[model samples]
Target: MSGPKEELGEQRDSTKKKKKKKKKTESGKKRREKQQEEEGVKGGGGGEEEEEEEGEKQQVEEEEVHSSDCIVLRGIFKLGKKSHDVLLTRTRLTWTPITPEMPTGEACVLQPGVMPLQDVFAVKVKRRRAAGQESGGPVLGVTLFCSRQRGRRLEEDTLHLHNASAEHTYTWYNTLKELVSGFSSRPKCLKVFINPSSHKKEAVHIYREHVAPLFKMADVSTDITVTEKKGHALSVMKECKLDEFDGVVCVGGDGSVAEVCHALVLRAQLDADSPEKPVKPVLPLGIIPAGSTNVVSCSVHGVRDPVTAALHIILGHQQQVDMCSFSSLGQLVCFGFSAMFGFGGQSLARAEKKRWMPSSQRREYALVKTLARLKPEYCHLSFIPVTKTTRDLFGHHSEDEDLDQDPGSVDAEGEGTWTTIKGLYLNISVMSIPCLSPHAPRGLAPNTSLANGSASLIAVGNTSRSEFIKHLKRYSSSSGQFSFSFVETHTVTAVRIRPRSQRSWSEEESEGEEGDSKTTPIIQTEGATFPWNIDGELVEIANEVLIRVHPRLITLYGEDMDEAESTVSCSCI
Candidate 1:
């Protein structure tokens, strides 16, 4: 769209044309004498150079008046084989065709174009001669701006600014380079981990094709490592020089990302000598979704596209996310953003055993198989709930008025005591960030947030198989899955789960349809290990475990939570 600058340009052109017509009406000798008198008054009897300089300054002021941002530079340049008037502002670069002075500058039929400075990552100047040669080709050169599109998705785009003086072109290039460099969030270098075995083993190809080119255009250096085996990323992270890179890039599924996150958290703790009170990671992380279920990437970037992820990294945009530390046997087990026990854990465990199959098919098989054998885990659970309280003569009246204010705020703390419940639960999920994905567009835990210093604790009590299935279906389309009668939801700072091990629990209550082999009654044995799914990785623990929520513990390259929009495609639920 045309801006005030265009209107002003047109008006300025019209005013000049009127002055020319008026001057033509006067005799040549009279015009020169009138100019000499005006120059004397305006320039204080100085030479023509003084008058010309004053006119240039006035023209610049006119251009400045039409823009809100500080005018950086202005010049005449060629774009698309046509000369145009170009204006650079602190926030954007704009250009318009320099049409002949007719009725007004608005008489120009072509529309103007603008490119936001934030999207421009790099700039380069073109020269006439070879780099090694003593001389160059033309006095004027074109400067190419390497930038990306701004929208739901980001794609690489370029613009060229041509000018008469190569020196001016170089100045434009340098000014743009300095501006792009001033964006402190944009990463200049990254340490990337690509899991070659993730999903159908396409992560390496995705990084090379979709991610590497963007990083190259942005001049973002990378120290890449193609993981050779499981836990390789974590192991390498421990040994690498952390100070050399600005951030870590994980190119795989949530499991691979989780492993790297866990490693970084642990490394930070080790370096700080504060294992008890761990600080946030030194470097932020970027996720490139190349797995079957890109849950973490989907939640952070709102899409599973690798190109979008690469753009976010190059731009250095970030979202401070909460991290969950799962502790068992009185020590840290691992760190993750979300976790699921009972039904979820069992399904993941089943899928882990079927690694020979494609990730999608294995997940589907595990889900179906687990659904058929859905049984509750009898356990003791305790949590410190977030509450809304106020000063009262007797007591507080309602929920915290700020409960709905900012989801990123720490859940009301120390206002209430720990609450405990002992029962048979089918599925329990703890989420710090909304686990957004194609299957759950609203997120698995919509009540929680990325940096809220709290987690959503959802406990699903035992119900008939069909009723549980109906509840699960809600996740495919909405966040009302917790609204079921048998489900209990809480916003809490911590959760402690102690499964009743060595207890034989009969599954007679779970079977709603008789005669089906999948619904047949089964008996449990002693000393059984409970399965846990922490960030898509399965773990087997027979003892009590504590899951604690730490606020803003790690930064991930992404947009803010409010702008995070996920697309729902899979109806697998």
Candidate 2:
């Protein structure tokens, strides 16, 4: 094919020929006739319509020929070195020239008709150096792109026509095909951020010794950044160049995962041009477990093994998982699991406070201390169930229950419900996995899916002290029995905790008395500090605390858990 420079030169020569023809037609007689005809049509509307039609045709041709970056397939005919062939469709423009040797940009006479789809044309390479210079360059390879029908001509003569059964065909090329061929390139590497300061420092070592090797095998490069302080991992993620790598991997527990999720959500929001824009700049996340609780990792991928998690990273599968955002005292926090207030809050707060002790020691201590001091406390809570209200009211919803609700439904009170939980432990969970109890095979909220729109809440009501002890025992024993049914999703708008003035209950109050209605009871809504649990971490709040669930407010990578094993709600999960 002629280069653009050569084609321009040919056009100049053609313009010169046109000028010569105009000079020859400069006679007064011919010019006068043309003027007379133009004057005759000047007053008519038909003449203007004809001109407009011609202009429209030219625009259509330009649009069709130059729609995308134009590429034309061409070939050499004279002194052909190889038997090159071309095939083209009716939708394609194709032709052959009569002269075998035309100067690069000079046009040759068309061969009177379009070339057959099976026709073959020989191509030659013409490498050109800079103007006023001469040098050899790389030779370009040219091949014919033909339909299967045309290519089949080489095998059998009967395959010439589109549906010909007996005819053979040959391939041909007429114009350069504009095709992009770089979309399938493999990811160069991954950027891994590990939080060593998390619950346990084993995460960094675990990822280095176990996870890195597998990613290397999969040809994913790695840039490891170990966090040193709280929110350090999230900071790195926010500052990192997201496009430099294929994906991001986090090694640590739920807190670390929460950090990553928050950063990602913020980044996503920043990258989007409008609030209404669907997710635009999402980067997939991989999780490696290295914390006191690897809830997010465990829920997404069935196993907690660091090596197994790393393998999932190597596989490079991505999923959109649900993350709940909570607003407490105007401060927003995104948690992979539920948040707690009241008794559940107190229990988790106590458990986390003991983390300074060794794991075995802490577990033993928590178990013994909780049992010895088993007691039931009560708090009036306002909850808005994310699921159906009727099912959530009586708690017929089991741990394995599946229900559907609006994806964006936040009721007038935000699906609110009110109840008084009796036990000392108050829990709110945005669970994504089954089997929260370490020792028991049973999951407190089995139906909770990773990307589900709603959260699973299993709160122990104000039951007897013995009952509370049994519920606590279930966490460390496989056979401990406790009812952990799914209830209407609950959000803690505000909780009022009142401790009983007298530590012990009065027998007279227990019996139905005439003054029972007037009696205020020992507990009053005053002078009490309530410890709260957010994803198993404890924080102390004043007498009243307010919380609300932000549905699908954050995003994470939800690993594939087979359909036979679990289900999701409203596609959020």
Candidate 3:
């Protein structure tokens, strides 16, 4: 509406106003964005700080869970052949070095060697004056008994800890006492049976000298019984109150151990069938070797050491073992580790008759005499093979599998396929265990397992006398015992033996036949019973018998075999 110069100036003014409005709007948007960015940075920083605080709290909780509530004690601990300055905690004892260079809080950051409080057995305190200190002074001594493993060997070790004051020493002792007592308690009571007439007649002497002291030291009460005769232990086992004692200990040979086990099993079975209480709780058994051949003790303890067996009992370690039951025509004959016929039975019989002789000389004499009169007995041997799984084939038999079945009720005659063999055999030995002894270190059935629910049937077929003698002698050697062509072995669940002839030769006739070396001995028809050696004891029975294995029927105090492999083919040495 104005002139040209005025119009131009108006246009410039409007343009400048538009530019100012645009600039104001852009600056407002940038200010809002800057405010948002500052708030975001502040929020992120707060979140990071909160996260850092939470992480520190979590670490504190983790430390609380790992550490115990007890006051930490630092001292020098001397154990077995080694010594270390260790930190004693509530749940663990940690070995650490005492050095002036260790910083205050940094010392706990290092990972120290540790032993759990549960492994501690007991602690003894002795408050005496130091060697150079005055009498009744502040020096105190403490010894800790603990189960420890040094390399490949696991055993009980004594740790001696010294302190400056009686109060400090007492505090350590009480701490260990509270820890061990909370976890473990020693066996309070035991029923001990000693066979006075056992091999060497040293059972009583051994118990008095070596065993009784340990029991006293452990504060274990024992009810002692010395059997008068062969079956005396069986009678005692039948009448004893099993609930009153923690375990039963047999101090004798394999024969005596068998008797105690047999009585216990039979009683348990009888109790199981009773209406009042059907539960058959099998008590654990411990064995002390004091006999001519302590095969049971040797097999269980892995050595014929009574002290070791006692320690195992005191420590309360248990391993279950398979039991074998034998019956003749529905009549229970006996329970034993091994059953032998033919030459083996006859040798045992000869040994029994020569009991008046020296224990060492008697067995050697009987073995020689029986070898001279060695003759194979014609019989039918039948057995049912144990069912093997893929895992069993690979030597991985799992112990957790339920294998407990009553062998007496199991019908081996009608249930499964039985492999039958008719032959003249020099020896027929059925072993539940390896039958480990000094004479047969690897055991007669060396490849056998303790709780595998199986037995080993070893049959030596008819062979020449020289070959037979060689086979018998192989038991003394570590190898080649089962390598002979005449020797055959089978893993069996149950076995039945039947003699084709009811005739049995007498010992006198056997001696007479041995005198006449030029003539081959003929089978006699005057007798009807054959000598059966159940463990080391001899019994005359009809040659026919049924034997079956019960798995884990009884528990023995000992270390268990770690691997499932059979050791029969392996050398004992």
Which candidate gets the maximum TM-score versus the true structure?
Answer: 1
**Residues 1-573, model 3: lDDT tens digits:** 569989999988986896677677876766766887888842232454488699999999988967775546776754434455777877787775454545554543445677776555567785566588644654456777666654222366666776556777777777777766664434678999999888888999999987787777656799999998867877887788888988889999878888888877777867677522222246788888888777777677666667777777777778888888887777677777789888877877676666668987777777787878778777777777775321122232122122323334445347555666676778889998877766676777877877787888887878888888778768766767777777777788788888765355564455575643232211111233577778787767755788988777788887653222122321211
Better of 1 and 2 by lDDT: 1
lDDT values for all models? 0.76, 0.48, 0.71
Question: Comparing 1 and 3 by TM-score, which wins?
Answer: 1
After superposition, the stretches of candidate 1 with alpha carbons farther than 4 Å from their true spots are 1-68, 103-112, 126-151, 388-416, 501-528, 562-573
Best candidate according to lDDT: 1
Scored against the true structure, residue 172 in model 1 reaches a CA lDDT of 83
Candidate 2: stretches off by over 4 Å: 1-187, 198-200, 273-281, 342-344, 386-388, 391-440, 473-529, 543-573
lDDT of 1 by residue, 82-141 (tens): 888888888888898877766754564677888888887767666567668876576555
CA lDDT, candidate 3, residue 320? 85
Instruction: Rank candidates by lDDT, best first.
Output: 1, 3, 2
TM-score of 2: 0.52
Cα error of candidate 2 at position 201, Å: 2.5
lDDT of 2 at 207: 78
